[model samples]
Target: MDTEMTSEGVAFAKQMLADDHAAEAMGIRLVRAGIGSATLAMAVTASMVNGHRMTHGGFVFALADTAFAVACNSYGRTTVASGGAITYLESTALGDELIAEAVERTRRGRSGVYDVTVRRGDDVVAEFRGNSREVRPRA
Candidate 1:
């Protein structure tokens, strides 16, 4: 959270993270957040490595997806991923610090698009595109 974020953004992020048990269990931390953007960080641990000794693609995707969720929901609306895809560009190993930065691309009515880039230091490891749909509360 940053000082520039709106009160709605802060509250939304806080509530979302609080209920995100998977992200918490995976050691994900919110780095910053704004109206239509968010950044999160996760560290690759032994359990995240695959048989080939590289970080599993699922873990990388999860990090990107979490960032996308936060970015899309920064408006204080409950936004969930309708669909998402990821392209793995590089391999990562244990002890690597992965940073996922998400940006909103467009929003039309209840549908929104977000892109998240997962990087290890200066190198990009994965790119994720997510489609979000805001869920309206029941009256």
Candidate 2:
């Protein structure tokens, strides 16, 4: 697990985000990178707020998902999440910086599993389960 796939893979992921309407709209930023892990952050602005003025759950989910994608794909051979889900345990308020970290869990021949956590300071906001599909690297 490298921070990004390969140098080219990293560039490719960045390029993929160019047309990602949600990524662009949410201002998600890639923060930390590792072979088996990736970290991401997003600011909770009014646009991300829910009716209660707290951060929307969808916004948190997207941040966690991006981190999961990066961590699972860091092998540079192209891995796509096959099956996964997440649970929201707590609400994060707007103006709080949301951070997500994806950690590798298990792997089979062509698939990998991971656990992603979203947090605000010391509070755990959400938990995510991610499954990755490993594919042959493009030459």
Candidate 3:
């Protein structure tokens, strides 16, 4: 396991997400994490279900998005998602467990990139590329 999402790491993410009301309303849980890698899981409730009773894409995105947030800020500083996107590779049912794995790509100056994989068991559900803004020290 990585150090990014250790006991302390989980606490960090919990606080961040708690600050984001929408994320909190979405029921995003910080399942596991390390220094550069992180894993998250969210249950598919009625609010997160699609017409076919499958998990909605937005719900999956939320999980990955939060994982990206945790992984990027795990270093004890804030990082904001500048821009990015995700591609859905498969469909997951209401009871399916979605997993997100995120790792840093690079950080130059004040920006960074993170790659996140969203999966259900062995099947990939979606993939995200996140661009983040590094938080500068307070003046």
Best by lDDT: 1
Q: Given candidate 1, what's the lDDT at residue 132?
A: 97
TM-score of each: 0.94, 0.82, 0.83
C-alpha positional error of residue 54 in candidate 2 after TM-score superposition, expressed in Å: 1.9
Report the backbone clash tally of model 1.
Answer: 0
Each model's lDDT: 0.91, 0.80, 0.79
Name the 10 consecutive residues with the lowest summed lDDT in model 1.
1-10
Q: Model 2 over residues 31-83: C-alpha lDDT tens digits?
A: 76666677888889989898888888888888988888877766566787788
Candidate 3, superposed: residue stretches over 4 Å from native: 1-11, 136-139
Task: Count backbone overlaps in model 2.
Answer: 5
Tens-place lDDT per residue, model 1, 1-139, is 4424676865696579778999999999888888888899999999999999999999999999999998998888888999999999999999999999999999999999999999999999999999999998557
- Report the lDDT tens digits of candidate 3 across residue range 92-111: 88677777888889988778
Which model, 2 or 3, shows the larger lDDT?
A: 2
User: Between prediction 1 and prediction 2, which has the larger TM-score?
Assistant: 1
What TM-score does prediction 2 earn?
0.82
Candidate 2 stretches greater than 4 Å from native: 1-21, 135-139
User: How displaced is residue 108 in candidate 3, in Å?
Assistant: 1.6
